[model samples]
Target chain A: DAGITQSPRHKVTETGTPVTLRCHQTENHRYMYWYRQDPGHGLRLIHYSYGVKDTDKGEVSDGYSVSRSKTEDFLLTLESATSSQTSVYFCATSITSYNEQFFGPGTRLTVL
Target chain B: AQTVTQSQPEMSVQEAETVTLSCTYDTSESDYYLFWYKQPPSRQMILVIRQEAYKQQNATENRFSVNFQKAAKSFSLKISDSQLGDAAMYFCAYVNFGNEKLTFGTGTRLTIIP
Candidate 1:
């Protein structure tokens, strides 16, 4: 665990409900990323932000959206949560994309 | 597209004994980075070791070291003096230069036997 922190470490929600996860970092890194971990799938990137207000899609960005209003905060929103979206989400930060990333303790989301 | 493969689904080693986890990757890029990450029951992703494609010397971090064969596209992790705390899920990852997104393998669960 680095200086990053994720909110609502554990949550249980229902399908079709909206959910938002927050990632905060004190390292002031230039890059931040959102990823989901599930069985048989180690970790899949959902989205990433290169700089404040600059964001891009990742390999599995569908059904997910991200916002970076500041360097320390990156938000991942599920407009309509689905059972398939239930998984452990992790947030990572790095000085650059090519550099090693520091991950936070993950947030576990469960959709019923 | 870059891909990482961890052939071992589960591995067990006696306490104080050593074990090796195999990882192979496929990539067309010449410059990239390879990493071994450990996830304990706590589910925290910890960096075990990392290797730069341009570096010929193997990377070592304490009791954890990597055998990197650029030609064979193989990067394996060797853990020495196994401890109970070492038991965890190990993941192999690859990241190509110019693109920071990491591609990960399915992961191998390591069990330390007393």
Candidate 2:
């Protein structure tokens, strides 16, 4: 749990629509990460935030964007949702970049 | 780039027996960290154990332990006296000492027979 929460445990939306997922943490960690879990792929990193207003792309950041306005909150957005983007999204945070991460319950998103 | 691989997609063990899950990774860096994470049906990811690349001794926590073969580039998890609650999808992850990203394996679903 690690004092982390993800909003909209489940979501469904049509293709071409925009979707945003929120991740909130109370630990005040300096590092936050967004990942998507698929059946065979396990989990893949979409984006990550080190500090407020500082972010970077991951292996699969083509259609995803992220923002961290505060130490406790990080948001992931999909400009235009697609079927390929449908998967369980997880938010993780850690005290340092190299430490073990704590994950949220996850948000299941579906794009039809 | 670092890549983690979990060869056993599924495994089963008797309630009171022991079982091992295999994991291997390809990393060019000499310093890194290896981790085992358990995701139950509830979808909660739990940290089972961790092994630092520089540590020669295997890490142990309760009934769970890791056999870290640095030279072989293999990390395996051993669960002793498995319980029914141990049924879950276990993932092997690796992160370099100074890297910010973690690479995960496909995962192995472990089942404990009652």
The best candidate in terms of DockQ: 2
Writing each residue's lDDT as its tens digit, candidate 2 over A51-111 gives 9999999999999999999999999999999999999999999988768899999999999
Best by TM-score: 2
Clashes per candidate, residues 3 or more apart or on different chains: 0, 0
Residue pairs with colliding backbones in model 1 are none
* TM-score for candidate 1: 0.98
Residue A85 accuracy (lDDT) in model 1: 97
Model 2: how far residue B107 lies from native, Å: 0.3
The per-residue C-alpha lDDT of model 2 at residue A42 equals: 96
- DockQ per model, Cα: 0.77, 0.86
Q: List the residue pairs that clash in candidate 2.
A: none
Tens-digit lDDT track of model 1 for B1-114? 888999999999999999999999999999999999999999988888889999999999999999999999999999999999999999999998899688889999999999
lDDT of 1 by residue, A1-112 (tens): 4599999899999999999999999999999999999999899999999999999998999999999998999999999999999999999998888778899999999999
